[model samples]
Target: SKFGTIYFWRVHYNDSSDHVNETFSFRPVQPGGGGGGMGGA
Candidate 1:
């Protein structure tokens, strides 16, 4: 990922009793610019 660039991700899970799915997004930050970038669910 590049600085200031937006990235997306998806998560999925399955079990005998349930199924789960989710989507998430976040932006990249510059190195040593602090912690991880902002994200949304």
Candidate 2:
């Protein structure tokens, strides 16, 4: 798996007219990417 990567998802409806949509994002962490493991190395 990759690290420090971001992913997004969205949905669209209708034929270029009125539509509903939503957006979301997230990132992956390597257990202790911020601290703890390996002295935050």
Candidate 3:
């Protein structure tokens, strides 16, 4: 998770014809209540 920072990602797909058929994208995940805490320290 990130500290409320804007993140972007994308994935491209192509066929055997060497043509880009589609493009997929999304914003992975968000931080928790502790502002992005990890395993118990």
Candidate 4:
């Protein structure tokens, strides 16, 4: 796991009435390197 490395991940959660699952990919960034507040999202 290095800087700016992209990885695939899974997220499981409940949406109101039913169960939900999601898959996404995101890049890692250095702390305070760019815009703040959930920069990878």
How do all models score by TM-score? 0.13, 0.13, 0.15, 0.13
Model 4 lDDT per residue over 1-41, tens place:
32222212222222222233222222233232233433453
lDDT of 2 by residue, 1-41 (tens): 22222111112122223232221112223332332332322
lDDT of 3 by residue, 1-41 (tens): 43322231112222323333321122232233132432221
Clashing pairs in 1: none
> What is the C-alpha local distance difference test score of each model?
0.27, 0.24, 0.26, 0.29
Error of 3 at 5 (Å): 5.9
lDDT of 3 at 15: 33
lDDT of 4: 0.29
Native-to-model Cα distance after best TM-score fit, residue 2 in candidate 1, in Å: 4.1
Runs in model 4 lying further than 4 Å from the true structure: 1-11, 14-21, 25-41
**For candidate 3, what is the lDDT?**
0.26
In model 1, where do residues sit more than 4 Å from their true spots? 2-5, 9-19, 23-35
Q: Candidate 1's residue-wise lDDT over 1-41, tens digit each?
A: 32333322221222222233222212123232223442321
The positional error of residue 31 in candidate 1, measured at the CA in angstroms, is 14
Arrange candidates by lDDT, descending: 4, 1, 3, 2
Worst 10 residues of 3 by lDDT: 4-13
